[model samples]
Target: MYKYLFLLGSSLAVAQPAMAEDGEITVTATGLAQPVEHTGQAVTVITRDEIERVQGADVTRVIQRLPGTTFTRTGPMGSLTLLGVRGAPAGQTLVLIDGVRANDPANANAEFDLSQLNTATIDSIELLRGPNSVVWGSQAMGGVMNIVTRIENGYSASVEYGGDDRVTASAAAGMTNEKLEAALSAGFVDAGGYSSAASGTEKDGYRQYNLAGRARYHVTETLSLTANARYTHGKVDLDGYPPPNYTFADADVTEKLRAWSGRVGALYDVGILKLNAGFSISDTERVGDDPSYPYSIDGRSERAELFGRVALPGQLALDFGGDYEWSRFSNAPDAGKAHNGSVHALLGYYGDRLIVTAGMRYDDHSDFGGEWTFGANGAYEIAPGWRLRAAYGEGFKAPTLYQLLSQYGNPDLLPERSKGYEVGVSHGERGDPVYLSLTAYRRDSKNLIDFFSCWSGTAPLCATRPSGFYYNVGKGRAQGIEAEVGLQWAPGLSSQFAYSYTDTENRTPGDVYRGADFARRPAHMVSASLDWESTMGLALGFDVRVVGDAFDDRANATKLDSYALGDIRASYRVNDMIELFGRVENVWDQDYAIAAGYGTQGRAAYFGVRLRK
Candidate 1:
């Protein structure tokens, strides 16, 4: 059925007036430094050009188009996305920025809003599906997402302004004549939208400013030193809405986050061994002002990691690394502390026709003892342009401080664990205009934790609202198939289409998670895009996306129906220093919710001009 659907999608794409051929650029996919042709796992990439064309409002909008992925938005700034490879929880996925981990330490059950990341500075993003903990460790039970930043060799600047209360201004300058290269960038964005049920009413959705810089110097022909620094701060006015009233104005509710993060690393290459070591740190502060709630939260996370890889004679490669992380969280009402240490190693063989990898890591936490995870992956060339790959891995997520020591907490909760496997094949001829990839995977989780019993009667000593206490309850499983095709059909005209089918179920009995299909696991998803690059310096693009039905509430009481969305974009190159562009979202005027409870922007269009040097 998926193959037939792909064929039909392909035909429609080809019928489009505009499409272009695919380009060649080997990317980092196999946890290695060098670019490789075949990946041992399902991988999807979004380029900067594509991001600009789509005018993607957030990370959710950009990632939903990928296979085996689903995003649920609670509001403009309140969003939780589930990237399931087979059927893993959203927490099973790991996100990285320039090789540094960025998962929130406050929550272990939900994914942080990917949209919080500024897109203006992103060069490219890589989404790898299936178990990758062998190389990434811990939360990588489902997949890994690596966001790479742009590297500039000279000065470049751009100014963008749009409707819907959207405006962004950015500039970048760098220098690299021969041996040394450095760059710096700054960006700011502000947007306002309707406050939920209050149609015609205004709300403060998002306002943020960011600054980043990087430098790299060649110490020798085979060695280099690189460093990067970035700082961002944002103030979000929380539109705290209760059940019926979608737009409840809470003048007292305001959220603020400030962060300072950076990385310093060195890389050396010798014929027999390749070495890389890096140290990264991110300090974050979160504060909330809600008179109705009453309290302020402050958190500080300090992390240091060092790793190296060496290749022995033959095709054998060995990687060993260790890390230490410390976090001290203090609230105006109280304070807590947690620290972690880990050591890991991976062994792999990369030959002409086949590659095999195995790895393991031991993690120790001041609060949760120690846990170990291991995995194996392999890929073999079956024929020209055809490769078969498989992977099996075990991953886990330790309970967060909020879960273990919240106002109503549980000290007996254990870390959730998952075991998963995936098999797939990829066929693509080098330089060919067409490429196809398919994958199937399954994942099972145990010791699933959820808020359990609550304290009855509002006792001052035991204040446990319905939020419940964290407990190890049910078991869950997920399986799915993903297929993707890309074709540059002829010239100037090209198209890309992807489809996914997922089946998710819960075996956790009891009132907590009884007889419910995972909270936000959409059963089916698809994305298709067509583009025409005119020989006359004109570009046109169209995209369609569909997400199947899924439950919105934890109890599965409210059902959010499936819906399809479409968008169009075009650009005209007027001259060497100027270009005019416009984009229209929800072209069909489909009234849909990108996230439950939050009203999405109605059909809207924006036109803007880009000035560059």
Candidate 2:
């Protein structure tokens, strides 16, 4: 019973902007767009075209092709999907949706749910691997994901049907002009999904819908106003232990979610000086009902942010920013409020062949007082097309409101903290005939938060509360090597491969799980893909993904077996404004599960048509 009480469940959120070219791609996650090479950071960008080239119905398909990336889903599509960079947990990897912070304020772990995110209206995804606490501040322990939505002058739509009576449809339309630009998009999904429990006999269905809008108006030559909003709603069937048997099995259970984010901002740019200011709001509501227990979460958050960049003499620049947020949440009879504010500054030198940067941050939390963070990174071009880079960052995540105000909340909990270091060398640029890079990195995290049980009699607080409360008694270390290679065969043909080797150890003293591998973190992961496009408006692609063995539980008692899966996708252009697409997933009908006791999809196929103008 105690094992079941561990922190469990997953979701994803957060975003920034990014633009890429063959070399010196721009990374906008820092609030200021900087060249990836000059920023001394390891980043991977997935464009809309790349998303279509890969087997998809979602963004996860393309996200897994990068090193130091791992994810898991409890069931089939629309399930609770979680992501991790290197060996960090889901909550440590912040996600941004169109410049808005989307992490769920009501979640016990304060993580964003990625299950509801689809690529239907997405234009690009940028993953900044490793911490850059100087800009991201809290929840930047692992990495950051920046997602940009389509907001150009155009119209696009797609519809598809697959196995198990699955149907997906999406449409987007927008306008762009000299003075003002605006766009909106919507998507829907309905599926007669299979059972979630491996031993269940009945089907568990799922239905979801989402909407997004973005607008920008040029008020002056050097000033612009921007606004964006996103909304998602979903319902899914789940399984639970029944009363009579009290065993892990199927039961009458369902979960419903309603979440949204909105932001209004202004931008000012005059070549040497740039400024960005914004105010945003995020809200989430969730309901779960089981025969045994029922629970609901209501949360809302608001934030105001401002950041600016000023160029100095001799290829030098100074960047500074600050943000304040207020969050409130309710879990039935219990309610809580939290406030946080942070300020940061950075100085950088952009020489012709060498770039260096350093920064520091100070955060004030109403619940836990204050903390400080520091970061530095540099990159040097050893040759014309090769470079050496390294980075160091310190990060901390404040306790969620739920962790401090709920029934089991602990008022004296400390913020979780981590330190990360990485260095690597690379050859060639993106799209080159041959591209290769490898990095070895390490991270140490302490004061990690976890549930402490009264039954264990570990803390004096058990004297008053009895059951359990959130506490900071966890610690660990993770180190790894990540490598990727890409090769271009013919003009329209290319292949890419990526691999990761991670070693994790739970280092909390006097704990049973100490020295054990981190739950859900595998030792190795590999991905390979091949793509071909002809001048005749035809394209074909195939990919294989492999995940090594891991443990599904902290005790490492349950072993998760290794699995490899393959997929094939093809698209044919019918005209300039229309196209036909289809894909076969889980070729060979490989039956496997990312979460123990969960059922996975068998060999399935989906066909669709796309219209664009």
What TM-scores do the predictions have? Answer: 0.88, 0.95
Kindly list the per-residue Cα lDDT of model 2 for residues 15-134, writing each as its tens digit. Answer: 233222244454443676666677777877677778767735566887898789999888767778888989998888888888788888788888877876877767777788888777
- Name the top TM-score candidate: 2
Error of 2 at 133 (Å): 1.8
Report every candidate's CA lDDT. 0.67, 0.82
Q: Encode model 1's per-residue lDDT on 61-172: one tens digit a residue.
A: 6676678887655445432334555456667788766666666655535344464577666766778777665566567767788776656656555555555677666667
- Summed backbone clashes in each candidate are 9, 11
Deviation from truth (RMSD, Å), model 1:
9.1
**Residue 4 alpha-carbon offset, candidate 1, angstroms:** 57
Error of 2 at 446 (Å): 0.7
Q: Which stretches of candidate 2 lie over 4 Å from their true place?
A: 1-29
